[model samples]
Target: MSEPKHVVIIGSGLGGASAAAALRERGYSGDVLVLGSESHRPYELPPLSKGVLLGDAEEPDWVREADFYADKNIDLRLGTTAVRIELGGRLVHDGSGGEYRYDRLLLATGSQPRSLPVPGTDLPGVRTLRTLDDSLALRSAFSAAERIVIVGAGWIGTEVAAAARKHGAEVTVVDQIQAPLEPVLGAEVAGVFRDLHTEHGVGWRLGAGVAEFAGGPDGVRSVKLTDGTELPADLVLVAVGAAPRVELAHAAGLDLSDDGGVCVDATLRTASPDVYAVGDIAAQFHPRYGKRLRVEHWANAKYQGEHVAGNLLGEHEPYLSSPYFFSDQYDLGCEYRGLADPDNDELVVRGDLKSREFTAFWVRDGKVTAAMNVNSWDDGDALQSLVDNRTEVTPTQLREADLAGLG
Candidate 1:
């Protein structure tokens, strides 16, 4: 067995930390270095826009703390970035004029906020909530703002809506899709969210895209909708989506997708031999389903990171992750298991969409491939498993039978 020398992990998000933790769990005592782009310590990121933004969660609760990483003996580098990756020479260039040498490199740089190329996009009062600093800045602004207009009806937008509403700011969400989270949950489930926000005194503008930004002396004043309506606003949030930060890898002679994301095989291995990609940046090829997927979700990143770490420590295990995502919009919790592709055929499941507490299964042909839920379970205990076990349940039976069997 080859003695593991040094493993360099970029981006100390949940994925990167999970990768390092998994390595330790499997009993690998080599050098593990975690490179974090953010200045803050390693932390959980889900509550940045939700619980933390609403003041129900604290910074101490979010971060894993400095001593934890020290106890683990993982070299945690804060305010550092691995922008240049050299596999042949086994070197990485940091943003702070330093270089790192590694036996194996893990690219967990995650994704970046997708920006809107509008007139007042660079304006002062406008921001997108992705990081802890972004949420803190927006929270400070929320104390004085009367109204906020969210430009996209995605998960981030919905979460921000909940956060702003908690802070007494009148929120309005505008999007091209008819409902919030249209791309992930499909029309049936997204419609539930569409009504969910509206019932809470929030405004919704469906089938409307931002035409242009109108700036004022104070900051951004109003947004010109494509339908010719000028919606007045004190703040604007461009919460459309995220693009993977793979330019450094792509420019360094690595094979990347047309979308500028790292291409990985079943084992999370890129074209480069010693370098592997994980998290939101690695576009993975699904061995079970025969499709290439680039999922920007918490679960995918954590699981993939662990898989790559296991493989790095002489496991040689194949990486196989069931595509999954979850969202906490208002009081309703939404989750999806397997690959919920709307492009596939029929959908059969149990759900009272109006009530907003049920599960829906997506079926293609006669086999059940995917399942989505509102406040569902994540127990893969024996055969009654959920996410990983994609059981074929019929529409009538699913609508009637107790889905708590998933527990």
Candidate 2:
């Protein structure tokens, strides 16, 4: 396809906004229109759980300034919900009964926090943190709430526990799993997170399930566990997980992954011609992993956005970058690069795990599949290079203090 005259992007999250900017950067003179359901302009998601919730950062980290859209001649439509995709006509219908025609359409609808299915979830104080509004509401609740009960010990739950504890709120985190973050970070590494929260006075109820939330008119009163124990809670935060927004894609007969994400190839192109998907909603083929994967990390979204733009401009190349993510809780800050399958790999630690200032490597078949650095700085780029290059190194070499040059 020749350079399209106009590109219509749905959803104004980081991926959507970055795609617009990247198209312009790549010298595409085509008109760009970004439709966002949220009123706020594109902002980073990390701060919503950390800085924004703790009142440490008030202003949002915008993807671009207000003038950026105007200067670049990009039409940014906020607070607009895309109701339907007219696949036959190549147009999008918004809730306001407006139709937008496009030479190409990119879906960056992102994902939403999964809601709890139990009763009393609709209570006033029971919340889930996903957007800036949710963060603001929790911040206000945190300032006044004495006892807080967090469901699920995932990244969002764990981070919120840290913020609540830091704000002097009595925090209790409950998860059905034996170790928090065990599924992703593995049992050994997840223990680190458990210790971090425990040291900060955060209560843990592992191998426990929430039966129901009992509350009065004032708000959520307490959470009832399956073990027949009731824990008093002034507020409840549910951090189970997220689900991709793929209704439009599904309705339009676009391919979808088994996990409900829009299915796309390595170039981020959907089965239908002229249609593309990116960000959390896109189950994109990763050349490195040799499989289609949907990643929710901010860095992956940003990279996919830029990479999709190149492909959209006819610079066709596979999206092969390794998965990466990071987190901050208490004084601990960590960055993990590459996809690490704990079941298939052996973890090797470089520094003392007890000191919590070390780099851990996931070695599979004598090659570094992933590396994580906790409370350590200035090694992310090198670690990422090691993964990208598929560097082969032994466990003893990984434990060496001067292992930087070895890889």
Candidate 3:
């Protein structure tokens, strides 16, 4: 089969921009069109919620400027939204009713923030942090809000709380779980977060779900919890989670998994040969874990973008970059490497939680399974390689030996 001559990537986020760069780097003399939904050029989103809100981060470039696309011979379309897909004809229809035929199509639409599913969610003071505009408006509201209620204890919720606290907004994190971040980080270890927030003067409402948002003319007056307690608040942030953008794929009859990602094999190819999905839209098979993984981290999008670009240009390489994710908030920064099951045994947690520097390794049945480190990148890199390589390490040795390097 001959290499595809035209590659059209939908969504100009980290994933789409990196894919275009990878395609040209691989010596693929093809037409690359990058379409972005936002009016701004492909810009980074991490800072919008965290660094930019904290006043420590400047507004940086998203990926490349508009002129950079011209320098790279890439076609850049900003403020354009892809509405639907026609698999048989291999065309992407835009919101404005424009159509473009492509030899291979990449769906990098990414994800949207999940909202609190309860009454008064439509209230004026209620907000969800996802896009640049969302963060900007939320930042403006923070200056006036006396008490801010943050629903969910995930990273985004915690990060926004940290920023709001920095802005002198009294913030409270309401979580249904026993502890903050227990769903992902495990309850035993996530205690650090509970203590971290409580000690920092951020209020906590545990074992509770939202009943409704009670509005009193100006804005939200208070948040009603499931425990029959009403917390006083002027602003609320719903950071429950994110849902992948899969409506276009679903409408086109592409197979979608329960997690809302388009199911694809290692090569990032769907059942329809001409259509390839990547970034947040693609749920790819992982041979390492022997399970299908749908990752939503920043790195996943960038790596999968490159892989789909190569696969489109006849390279046929698999998308396997070792799933990793990280979070920075308050006084803590964490980086995760490799995949780990929460049910796995033989977890080695080192360092002191009281002083906050620590690293943990997940070993399963005598092999390194997954690892997480807080401000401990060196140890994380070593353990991650072991997990990725399936290195064998006994519990006794992992506990006793210093993990500076396995070199």
Candidate 4:
């Protein structure tokens, strides 16, 4: 097929911005336009919950310099929301009544934070962190907050607890799950995180649901749990989870997956031939895993964005990489690679778990499915290689200090 004459990308997050950059770098001089819902340029999300919430960074990590798009002759419209997509005519409509026709279209519409389904959520101090503005607002609130209550023990919830503690706020995290990150990291590994936060003076009320956000006109005053227990708090953060932004695609009659994202083939193309989806909103058929999986991590956004650019130019290569994500809470930092289920995989540990320095591997039927290194950066490559290659390893081999023979 002939190269697309014009490419329009909706949602100017990291994935969309990276696609535009890759297109330009690959010598595609086509007309490229990127529509961003936020006023600011595309920025990374990791810093929002870490450095930005901690008040250590004033601004987000930009995916590209503000001048990069202009220099490449790319039309990047900020603070623009795409309202509709007409697949029949290959046109996209924005909120301002502006319409653009394109030879190829990309839906990089990322996800939004899920709000706590409880009363008084709209109160002044009850907030959710998903954007740069949200992080700034939380950072400002944390400065004077005496007691902060975070609903959920996910990455954002735990990270916010660390930040709140650093700001000298008495923090308590409440979650429906029995342990933080239990579903993703399994119980053995999740216990380490729970202990780490506990050691840092972060309180937890696990396996409990939020019945209500008790507050008056002033702001949130306390969080009432399902067990009729109430915890007083001046600030509250609801980080339950996020839902993919797929309204435009749904209205356009696109196919959606059970995972709540736009369904795509192995090449990241939607049902419509010239349309594509990437990042957190894409439920793509992974070639390596042989299943349709949607990843909501930074690495997926960065790599899939660049990969889709090549496919848009007729490269038609399949994305076969494993899912990966990292988190930093206080002095404990860890990186996880691959996809594994706690219910099906057996957990094995290497190095010292007590000292907070170790590599944990999830093996399924003698093959390594996933691995994580906590404060042990040197073994990252070895662990990643094992997961990527589906290397068959015994518990004894995985526990061995030498990783030279794993690959």
> TM per model?
0.93, 0.98, 0.96, 0.99
lDDT of 4 by residue, 1-407 (tens): 68999999998999999999999999999999999989998999999999998888999999999899999999999999999999999999999999999999999999999887679999989999999999998999998889999998998899999999999999999998988999998887899999999999999999899999988999999999999999999999999989999999999999999978999999999999999999999999998899999999999999999999998887788988899999999999999999989878988999888899999989999999999989988877888789999978899999984875786
Best-to-worst order by TM-score is 4, 2, 3, 1
Write model 2 residue lDDT over 1-407, tens digit each, in one string: 67888799999999999999999999899889999999998998999988998789996689999899989999999999999998899999999999999988999999998987788888889999989999998998898899999999998999999999988999999999998898887899989889988999999999999999999778999999999989999999999999999999999999888888998998899998799999999998878888889999899889889888977776678888888889998899999998889877899998888889999899899999889999999787779888998888888877864666865
Error of 1 at 22 (Å): 1.8
**How do these models rank on lDDT, best leading?**
4, 2, 3, 1
In model 2, state the lDDT of residue 273. Answer: 77
Q: Which pairs clash in the backbone of model 3?
A: 43-62
2 against 4, candidate with superior lDDT: 4
lDDT of each: 0.79, 0.90, 0.82, 0.92
Worst 10 residues of 4 by lDDT: 398-407
Which tens-of-lDDT digit does each residue in 254-351 have in candidate 1?
88876667998888888887788888898878776886778888888888987888777655666776777677767888667776666564666465
Q: Candidate 1's C-alpha lDDT?
A: 0.79
RMSD per candidate (Å) reads: 2.3, 1.1, 1.6, 0.9
Extract clashing residue pairs from model 1. Answer: none
Report the backbone clash tally of model 4. 0
